[model samples]
Target chain A: MSEALSHRDRCAIAGIGATEFSKDSGRSELTLAAQACRAALQDAGLTVADVDGVVSCDYDLVSYGAIADALGIADLTYWGQTGPGGSGPCAMVGQAVAAILSGQATTVLVYRALNGRSGRRYGLGAPDPDARVGGRGAYEEFFAPYGLVTPGQFFALLAQRHMSTYGTRYEALAEIALACREAANRNPAAQMHERALTLEQCLAARPISLPLRLFDFCLETDGACAVVVTSAERAADCAQPPVLVRAVAQSTGPRVQPGVMYPMLMRPDITVTPSQTVARTLFSRAGLGPSEVDVAQIYDCFTITVLLQLEDYGFCAKGEGGAFTESGALRPGGALPINTAGGNLSEGYVHGMNHVLEGVRQIRGTSTSQVTGAEVSLVTSAPPPGTSALLLVRG
Target chain B: MSGMFNDVAVLPLMPVEDDHDTGGFFAAARRGELALRFCSECGQLLHLPRQVCFACGGARSEWRAVPGRGRVHAWTTVTHQVHPAFPTPYTVVLVDLEEIDARLVGSLPGEAELEVGQPVRVRFDRAPDGTTVPNWEVEA
Candidate 1:
């Protein structure tokens, strides 16, 4: 394997900011985007006028030019949009890093804002006939006739298979939900903060899909999150310490088709996925391992995803993620503190952008729930079916 | 007035083309067998077949008839139908093909009992015009 790129060769996240996590923002998505961008610029000791590039997901309600104009950005030299849902944020970071490395732009802003909680709830399973531009339409046409429409229903099938094959009980899965809730208790910004939830409470929660309780699912919050990325050289001159991008990679699984069965099941390798391939590449490139990571902010759209990521990232062996997560291993002061800002399970879901912001906070030494001497952090996504790892050090 | 009445009558049965690719797909579905185009150079199977190969960017491709036999990779039993056209309670399965290393999502027969690796064969239901959609059924 090739040596990982040095911190100086790539870009660093200079600032991270977010709107208040709530059920209702009462503002438009465009307004949320602007607020988050302005706050991030303030955190970076710069103004919106300093930003020369922008990257976001294609599904975002606000356009890049609109956000730039709203924020009073003079002109954008580089703009990128990613396809997959949650994967957009990490992919944007990858694009920003490439833009900075290639000299296309000096400073790039990455943001995700949505009215998912108050406006459009993703949990309500339905196929929009108007969404006929991509593979989603084809999948819907083929599968909707048979009944698989909701994401939870689709994932529940996978969970059922795991339960049968690995003897993973529903209670064991509930443990992950409980642990995340306990972590959220320490974070004031978390939606479920200070609300101690027991396994019984999690089990008692209403079922969206069989084997998936309301608590097992992530909250849909009306919120926006932004991060500022610049060249390591510029980061050195900035006010906040840079959370350098150590190594980044993305991969697709063997299924070779979107919403396909081979990749989803019968692959005989659900425990370790293509996301792990990216994780391994990242660790090898950076010359670091799971042990070296001080904090991790994994995509927690569902608890099963987190368990699978743990194994795929080599945090534990295959089928051992259940045992690995048991006994508060993910809690603060544990062996490896993960999702310190309350994961999507407890924190607001901004398509895992908040996870990235929390990562920057951990490195900046300003996290509300700070981990002492945190140096390296890993942020991931569950969409576009990929993972991107960054190694940050105190500079 | 006659033309408008005829247009309203034809609207329900009108063949709506979602995209250019769907046109090609419905063409293949007219035949009893199911086919997916695979790049001859890289041997990569294309789903929702496009004009070119996404993997190797190769242009030359050939259509091959597959047995349409596969194992259920993942599935969900949906109890709610958000769309007016679809009825409540359906089964959707991701089928992993044995012929080429590829997977496709399709509706499975609601009455059939399915396991993760259950064997299935392809069945198509004729829609409006000559188009037939590919569905799955348990192999006898």
Candidate 2:
């Protein structure tokens, strides 16, 4: 827990890029990866020859070498990937920072490209036993046979507990859904940009699982989003304003094993997620606190994911998320405007990569729903088997 | 099971026969009993059976049968069907097996009014795949 030798502000994100978000990209994952990588390099005033490192999520269909090859990057010095999906975006940036500070590579490309809606959708439920490889490990035997398949179903049990424990209401969830949709309405890049959601519409949405409705789930979208990372010194010479990486941390609570994908059954208390640990480590390393965060891009894979993280990340006291969100804290003019790019909820589900892009945008003063004078932005990965978070400050 | 909902037959994905970790649990279920793996060295009970003891790093574990009754910790009624095999509208419950210090998830195939902390007992049902798996019935 030595915080004195922190890597805060050692690296910066100098470029950001993405392709059109839609239900079907109509392109191969590799093409999407190459398109986003080229755009990111061009954004940073760099080129394929400038990039020596590559990083992505393990669930990404395209391999790191394939991306570098597609973009004409030769002689890569470093490449890596983080796993289990959802909890990857911020960690990917963290990987880039570690690589840069350690001299494994000079310039790194962090990207995520997938046609999630049209290909291998996560919410479609469990894969056939024969179809699954090594990661799950006796997982389906315990839950799938009983009809507990999708991530949404597991979160429903958690949300139900939180509701029973804290009196959290569905209307509070509606508040979160409405806020993101309102933000999306202002951002043309958002899939839900043209569509505005009302409290009434959110509240009345049909149930996918109890205590969680259709709107509660994030959009299953097809898209690719990426960012370019380099040494803070090098970033200053790039094209766009550098968003300094203040701190990043990833953690998993004790006893969160065995049920790798969804460990709800083993957890003593399902209300708290791994974000609690990540928050403590992230802020401690950054030499800052939650009160200093001007805006956030908390992952919204599900509305409950947002609610639990609100408490776990210390945005509010435990069990106070419902009332806190109801107070409009997550809205545009509220205390902390989150998911300003509409997030995974409305913008697109490029996993949480879009959240990272939005965080960088807020720092660069380029966000469509930009928070006025926002200097410090927080971006968190999904709250699950494990979680990660990052702090970006205006450089 | 008189009031159970059976209109939609569910043929859920069954366990792989050679899965070393979960094979014993399924074998016990076929015999109309609920069993879980316990660390032979440290006595830590584990569900979704594990190869080693997480509590003490014990390398050996063994299967033990326990009472099938427990209280519902939390639950959800899934209205949307994510798989073709499982039709819409099924209630899944997480039961806290306080007696064995373990937890398990099973579906309520019949109509039952369920709530947190309500008593539930496990019942064995044969899947369409010809494998016996544990489901739940609310105890009146």
Candidate 3:
């Protein structure tokens, strides 16, 4: 138990890779998964055969066995899936580190593949009603039928509560969209690269749900992203300088609510996210405060999400989120540069794996929108805040 | 928004999602009363009915009638059409039920000045299929 608390920096992510960010990749998810995994392994100076362990985000439509077949990987010592979104690449890295430390596996590969735009519209609708019918909960069965279908509508409740409690303005959320779009304009890979966002355009953008406008939602992108993790010793010899995992922590609120949206009835404060609980353990394990984080790749499912995360991650005080994000602090050359790769808003939603890749890039000082002298990058995942935060340090 | 529920011309796609957990809710709505789930062993009020008590892990459950008065805990007006049954610019609300100690998600009829913590009352409205759904009522 004590060893578990002190195991930070034991494993390092040696490589990161992703397919082109796009609205339509015109390829099966299996193909995208194989391509990304191959790219990551090659980047790490390791072959598929060297990988004895595999992990996947729960949201990934492709299964581990299918990906292994596509990668031509023969044997596996450790294999598992962390989340459909409850835990993402960061948590997967945590699992990989645990396996390596226990001698259950040496090299572990974590990947997330989704054809969100072409195959399944992530922003459009509810889960399969058949699944809901066979079995579902309040949000699905009771709440969903009342027109609470899409994630935007679900998160709208959070955004509304946040605004009411803190007197937050729409302009606060607009700052995030503007900052991310500006960063995306600098990066050629961003899906919304040329499409810069202005505060006027953002405010005037058609409302999807009140308190959440069109600019609030993330792009419906098609792609896959992957990362390679190995022993810290092994990563020291890899082609790219190792990005050590200083700390990786995944946590849920007091209630063990499963699925995309946990019933918020159990929680006292409607404005708080899982990131609040997650950030404490993450910073504790890393022995570093939020102020030490040079760059951040916070999950930007919605602009309001960025505001909530900034507060939950302790960048500001509770209810000070609206004021905290008003400055250009999240942009390039700002106080705490965030989402340098444009994030899910302007970049692509590789289901938070892209955020992890950006975190690794920031640590390595190779990001196109690089923050100068970034030694540590804090990356966070999406909500119920089925959130995980990882601190990556330059090796 | 006020009472679009009064629009006899509109037909709802699926008024309620019927499952083991929420079958009682629709049944209660049919009888013109708001009912909620409670774990007797745990003495806890539960929403989105669970087969087992999540807190105490006890399977025994029962339903109790609630007064159906609540405050708008959080709400949003969805301008986008998610389902044809629910038209554009509809307001969806999560209500914190008053003495009952539970929360319910319901819709307000038409565009109205709504805010969090505003007092509201629940009223039974007919889904096109005639299944009763609890809708929120407020003086716009």
Candidate number with greatest DockQ = 2
- Residue by residue across B1-140, what tens digits does model 1's lDDT show? 00000011111111233544434454565566667777788988766555467889998877667767888876655554444444545566778877676666666434346777888877766644444556667778
Q: After superposition, which runs of candidate 1 have C-alpha atoms over 4 Å from their true positions?
A: A1-10, A129-140, A253-272, B1-31, B38-64, B79-88, B97-102, B106-113, B126-131
Q: What are the candidates' individual DockQ scores?
A: 0.18, 0.51, 0.46
Clash-forming residue pairs, model 1: A146-B91, A261-B94
Question: What lDDT would each prediction earn against the true structure?
Answer: 0.71, 0.85, 0.81
Error of 3 at A181 (Å): 1.1
Task: Point out the higher-scoring one by lDDT: 1 or 2.
Answer: 2
For candidate 1, report its TM-score.
Answer: 0.84
Choose the strongest candidate by TM-score: 2
Which should have the higher lDDT, number 1 or number 3? 3
Contacts from the true interface found in each model, as a fraction, amount to 0.17, 0.62, 0.53
- Better model by TM-score: candidate 1 vs candidate 3: 3
By DockQ, the better pick of 2 and 3 is 2
TM-score of chain B of 1: 0.75
